[model samples]
Target: MAETTAETTDVASQYSAQVASDLEQNLKEQERLSAEIEALQAQLAALQHNHSVLTNIQQALGTSAAAAVSAAESVTKVPAPRKKTATKAAASRRTKSQKPATATAKRAGKKTAKASQTQSAAQSAAPKLVELVRAHLSAQSEPRSAAEIAAALEQEQPERGIKTTVVRSTLEALVAKNQAQRTKQGSSVFYTSTDTAEPAADGDQSEQPSA
Candidate 1:
């Protein structure tokens, strides 16, 4: 009886030791799983904080970019008002310092009136010269120089200062008007009237060619 009791006590002690070892292994496994869960949570928190930081940086950069764009547009747009103001000021100064536009117009009108009077006198003078040229041409059979015409007219009417230059210019004008034609010999121009009623070629007068 005593030997059986001792063997039963030894088996009981061995069974208790096996159960304690199994319990210790289970505690170690639980510790490893807990550590893995804690590491995963820490990594997740770090990822979330990085995402928030990136979002904030992007928002700040967008705000600054918008401000920069607005500033650049203002730099170009601001000059238009200043230019308009300067133009208005320049025009006002010119208005104060310059003469009235009508005064300048009046001076121009005076010059135009004097020019009109001169032109009218010249038109009137042309007819008198034409009459004198025609009368001389009608009386002659041979062509005569303008100087000869002027000299004859001066003898005929000596009271006037009938210039040779005036008669020459008049003869030239008659030639331009086709009322007379000119023939040239050496250095002289001679005038011949183109009319049909002059003294006949074989009548009392004879044509004298240039000597």
Candidate 2:
């Protein structure tokens, strides 16, 4: 009976030691699982933060792109106010350009008027050349050649540029008007006045062309 009691006590001590070891191993496994769970939670939180940042950046970019498109559209529209301003500027430039043309035209008109007035004054100042020729023909009692009449008129009025050709043309004109007589002796021609009018004083003739 003493031996059996000793064996029973030894078996109980062995079972107590095995139970303590098993309990210690179970606690270590639970600690390792807790650490792994904490690491996985940290990684998940970091991924969520990155996702939020990326979403915000995308939204900001989208807003900026929309604003840029709006600005482009506004520029392309070409509104009425801009058109009116451009038209007014063009009109102003045209008016400025036309001012010189208008001034030039006015100056040209004044010059033309002055030239006309001067020409009229010159015409009024000069005497009719036909009357001088008639008066010279009436003064002669005998028939005279065109050269002789031209020379006499040139001596009488040195300022008058008398020409023989012009005197011949005037004598022909007087014959055509029935105011003088033309006599042809061989190749030479002579003229005499048919009118019985009195003679004029110092007959002045010119080299003016016959009308």
Candidate 2 residue pairs that clash: none
lDDT of 1: 0.68
How do the residues 59-112 of candidate 1 rate in per-residue lDDT, one tens digit apiece?
655655565555445443433334877867755655543443434444655655
Model 2, residue 144: displacement in angstroms?
3.5
- Winner by TM-score: 2
Give me the runs in candidate 2 sitting further than 4 Å from their true place. Answer: 1-90, 113-129, 140-143, 152-162, 182-190, 196-211
Q: Name the best candidate (by lDDT).
A: 2
Per-residue lDDT of candidate 2, residues 16-118 (tens digit): 9999889978975774565456445645775786577557655655655565556445544544444877967755665665565556555655665576577
lDDT, each prediction: 0.68, 0.68
Listed in order, each prediction's TM-score against the native is 0.34, 0.36
Residue 84: error of model 2 in Å? 5.6
